[model samples]
Target chain A: MAVDEVKLLGFWGSPFALRVEWALRLKGIEYEYVEEDLSNKSLMLLQYNPWYKKVPVLVHNGKPIVESLVIIEYIDETWKNHPLLPEDPFERATSRFWAKFVDDKFVPLIIKMSSSTREQKDKVAEEAREILKTLESCLNLNKPFYGGKIIGFMDIAVAWIGIWAPMLEKIIDVKLLNEEYMPLLNTWFSDVLEVLVIKECVPPLDELLAHYKDYYDRFMATKA
Target chain B: MAVDEVKLLGFWGSPFALRVEWALRLKGIEYEYVEEDLSNKSLMLLQYNPWYKKVPVLVHNGKPIVESLVIIEYIDETWKNHPLLPEDPFERATSRFWAKFVDDKFVPLIIKMSSSTREQKDKVAEEAREILKTLESCLNLNKPFYGGKIIGFMDIAVAWIGIWAPMLEKIIDVKLLNEEYMPLLNTWFSDVLEVLVIKECVPPLDELLAHYKDYYDRFMATKA
Candidate 1:
């Protein structure tokens, strides 16, 4: 017995939840996926993630782990099959650096989408551009994936947002990750999507956009 | 020869930079600390962290690790002495989770400090309260530190801002972490400060306040 009882509590419309699902699939690990309704969260999910009380909680042998990036790393460490991070410490540190970078920058971009004024949106746009530029420069364009041959933890951590950016641009009527403007990011996006696991794990663009729209509306309505 | 030539490039007033300093001191690792002027960052520092070009870049045995939290973890992993994270996977994940939680919440608080409008300040105040409540609830008051029996990675990671919350309250004229409001957080502040290494590493409160005031003024002036 491999202590193989694994389960995930997630929402289909959530990109954060998808990161964990994709990592589990990529590792060829079998587990149960319990779709969480955000409107009516399960008591188990709430109990497991009492701090944030949010989705994508992974329970392994009855122990719970929250936060998508944290869960991904946990999975990597627990099951050594199909290594997600590089063996080299320097490489691993570099990848984790970008993961934090992406996580930190996501906040302001979300605020921009919920901003009530044009000035605020413009300011956020500039902030978002700087973050995108940082990501662009850090990326190794010559590599087929973020990890060169295969997707790694950094790739999985950011893989969801890469899809969301273009869809968001479409909905907002303003481009964020334009191929003409960011040739490297554009190429990397295509390369990331080439992976069967990632492609399958991604929710449809239309559905993601709809979710973002609903979230934005709810956020703004609360403000009003 | 242990290949132990370690040098840290950092700015004097950055909390992020202080994280590495505190970790090194706690681990009893001797290293050179090179304070870089943020306005005129050293070429080596720039080259070492080209993407972010930010402070708290640690070079160990000639290899550079950027990002404060990332560098902290790298130092912990490489040293394998005076361990900052717990050995158990679940506990380690929990420590990392709180660290990430702290990192995530500071964004809005920083933004509020930099904003011009009272409305913006109010919005951030609400956000800050939510984060504080989470912290005050998640943390065990009886434990002297976040990691019981010792000041660990999560404590040092957030210690800079944790100490500054009172100073931040002084500036904004609001008491978010006062004993009257949050007895546990207030007590934890003194608890963390009781550590000799952490006590010595903290910059003077007056200097920190002065730096933030200068920054806040300039930021608002630019917006005007």
Candidate 2:
């Protein structure tokens, strides 16, 4: 049976959740959004995601799909308009490879940098810069975004960087990317953030900073 | 231009390499396999996969696609035969979620157990059993393989568990999955091993054991 209704379970400030929101909006699919507090996860969130209990679970026709990337792929395949991924098989695979890179290297580094003290944050500065440098190499000075003129799967997958990095830099006092460090990537992030869809998903900067500040403090305290 | 030729650079015992091999053979696609000696990677491999500089680089026509899962997806889409993933987008997403689980939890736990001291090996036994138990629950008292009746993507993704787990058990002296702990999963592993395509990709057990034993020794030495 074709699914009739669509719904999403998410937290407002979560980059993972934002990916789904942006994909759905770009596809122009209308759906209800349920915000979950990570501290006190609701029954629906727990029921939808029994294993990970994480947000960004999409419920289509009452069936729940988990994991942000998996959810993003689901949205792309289900909605034909505004195709997030490329049509070519090899191109699709290349985009997925970069998506995996975002998950494996980029997101974890952001989390680690966010949760570290000033000294500890300094320790990962070069490693973080190297990741951006790799991204710059992909840009090739002519391509505007990861998708070569379009906001692509990898671009949306990385959209969090534009929104979250500024907050992280503010709290950690570590400059991650700039014209000096990664010229192309710095411009790419700027380009991504300027998009209407991308800008709409980003929580207000002041609210985000206040939330991450407390989150970082709690995270580091537990680690200590 | 359409991709005219396919080539693979691989090392014999790597599960990652075996994934590409099984996917190609299952699709009944003809390709040249270049065996790599890990001690000295070929210039082609270095050029094809300069990022990771690792084996299991699939050169379709001339372009290189790295990463095991991404390469498998590319092969499935490009060939259009014996589809590795399900047709339904949600089902495809579900299989990928488990594939991520295998990479994130299953492989790491196996590596940790393989290189652990006797005491540490004993400590991870219960944890390892728990992971298998969760997999067993996914079976829900039915389903021969992760892809239902077929030896599909997840089955290929996890073929290593069937082959390598037994070898790890013998060397580490820790039973990961068996009739007692995860009966359905143990049987599924056995059945997957019996697949001709899967069996052909696996290195001989004695050779694998010897290779892994040395690998474990070197891994522990570095940690010590």
Candidate 3:
């Protein structure tokens, strides 16, 4: 049976949710957006995602798909318009590589930074530097986005990292995206922000900052 | 230019390397296999995989694709003969979810079992149980493989993990995949092993155990 109704369950503050929303919008697919409060998730959200119970679950014709990357791929394949991946086999694989790389490296780096002691944070900082170096090399190829000409799968998959990188610097007091350390990454970030779709999809900077501040305050209070 | 040559550079003991071999065989794509000695990797392997400089790098018509999951996708797209992924978008995403899950969870479990201190072994064991439990629950869909009937991408992506799981239990003097703990997983293991491509590509158990023992010995010595 061909699925007609597409729905998204997401938290407004979540970059993962934003990525799915952007992909759906770009594909010209109309989807009902159900905002999820992460602190107190809806019964529907829990039912849809019993395992992870994470937001950014896409329900298409009543079938729920979880994991932001996997959801994005589902959206792309299901909707033919505004292709998210390249038609070329090698190019698609390249994009998937970067997507997996960001998921594997960047998210964990941020988590480590958030939870680790002062000494461990230093080691994580070094690890983050190495990951950024790899991205810088990929950028050196002169590709405007990770997809070469347009924002493709890799860009969306790592979109959360791009959004969080600047905010993390504020909390950790480490200038990570500066031109001095990561010139290419800085350029890439600027290019990504200039995209109309990405700009629209991203939550306002003020709201994101407020959310982070609240979390940091709570985390520190617990530690005390 | 439609370049038809497919070459896989691999180390014998690596499950990642075996994934490509099984995928290629499943697709019935005849290709050249170059076994790389991990201690002394060939220049071609290094040139092909400068990023991680790791084994199981697939060079298709001179372009290198590192990472096993990425390589499997490339193989599927390149060869149109036998499809590793299902035609349905949701089903495809489901397969990929399990693949990513196994990739994220199984790799750490194997590494921990192979080299973690005795004090840390129990913690790792507990973590493995949790992940395997998730897998078992997902397996309730009544599928022989991760997909309904035929072995799909998730099966091939995780085929290597099942091979390593038994071996790791031997190393730790524990039964990780016992029928008592996970009867579904035990049945799934039997089903996955029944596939001809997986059956043929798996190296002899003694060979893999010998290789792992040597690697573990050296790893422990370095830690000492």
Candidate 4:
């Protein structure tokens, strides 16, 4: 196991950081987790990710790899158990495409929803509705996860949506991803949360809310 | 041959579009190139890619794949000859990471460098120099390409730099990426242009400069 010593530098409340943690756990890969204070990053974090200056940098045998999804792919390939991606090239492409779509489309919109004032939340809801509908189409009611029955790459890529979106909706007082607008995606939110692996990784909601509230206060103070 | 029919819907002026063209030619895959007018999009283009409505949509056996790099990866996997990616997992991950860094960091900085007015161009040059320096560090003086000896995914991903950056320097009158600042990167640029597969795919300099001039005029008019 000495040859397999993996180290992950992460932050507690960040969704991107959580992704690496979940991937490591899913693959049964043992990694030493170093919690980073993003306000003042560690020397190792800086050395690992000089460009992004962000969390979720995976260090394996003194080599540090940045980018969360890239880290997941590396982890999946490095460890042969519980495959995250598909064997077929097209299927793998599809998973990567949607995972990218989720990052590009939904992540920013969710941020916009969370960071807006209560008055602006209502106006942002329309754009949020359209994004959710597009995401909704990617899922299948017959299949439990995005990559079919097993927890595959796309499922792990968006596992944060289920845990985080509900809190954002509650905080902003806007209904962006509820069942009426996006039935299948809404169902996915519920289903992915119930998966034992995902459930364990998501920190408690109250704790998350407290963290986000502090963020919201900081954002509001800046606006004022 | 019938089942393998691949069609690329693209705009000649776009570097992103050129990437797919180069990959297809390299792999010896036959594909029909449909020139798209971005201002007045075709119905098929709209139908195939409703969200981005962008070029370089690769249609293989009827399904349309969007996103330039994603399409290139799909093509490489599907065709398999003259492989764009390495078979090793770590090497593959490194290729993906740098490809993404090019897109996220270098591409936008290049755009900023290209689009700025003469007065602002001087200020932007400092930033451009930093980006080029970081990119330079990735190369090896001993190797022709990023992966060495052969043309690869990183070479294709960044081949635009060789073709476009020189024209941009001439147009903007800014010398951000010269041999002094980046000897290895400057050499990489020269080496990439010499490859026959790349030579055939890149549009002529005069045509590209004219296209960029028109873009520059449009950009100025909007700012005015």
lDDT of 1 by residue, A129-172 (tens): 67776777768757767666788888887777678777666655
Residue B185 error, candidate 3, Å: 3.3
Ranking by DockQ: 2, 3, 4, 1
> Least accurate stretch of 10 residues (summed lDDT) in model 3 chain B?
B139-148
Task: Enumerate residue pairs that collide in model 2.
Answer: none
Docking class of 2: high
- TM-score, A chain, model 4: 0.93
Task: Evaluate every candidate with DockQ and list the scores.
Answer: 0.60, 0.88, 0.84, 0.71
> What C-alpha lDDT do the candidate models reach, one value each?
0.80, 0.84, 0.82, 0.84
Output the better candidate (1/2) by DockQ.
2
Give the top-scoring candidate (TM-score).
Answer: 4
lDDT of 2 by residue, B1-224 (tens): 76469999999899999989999998988899999988988899899887788979999988899999999999989998798998898889888887887888788888788777789988787777787777777764466777777788988887677787788888789978778857788888889888888777777889989998988778878989
Q: Relative to the unseen true structure, what is the C-alpha lDDT of residue A102 in candidate 3, on a scale of 0 to 100?
A: 79
Per-residue accuracy of model 3 over A33-57 as CA lDDT, tens digit each: 9998888989999999887889899
Give chain A TM for each model in order.
0.92, 0.92, 0.93, 0.93
What is candidate 1's lDDT per residue for B65-88, written digit by digit as tens?
A: 998889988888878788998777
CA deviation > 4 Å runs, candidate 3: A1-3, A116-123, A140-143, A180-184, A221-224, B1-3, B115-123, B137-144, B147-149, B217-224
Flag the better candidate by TM-score, 1 or 4: 4
Report the Cα RMSD per candidate.
Answer: 4.0, 2.2, 2.9, 1.8
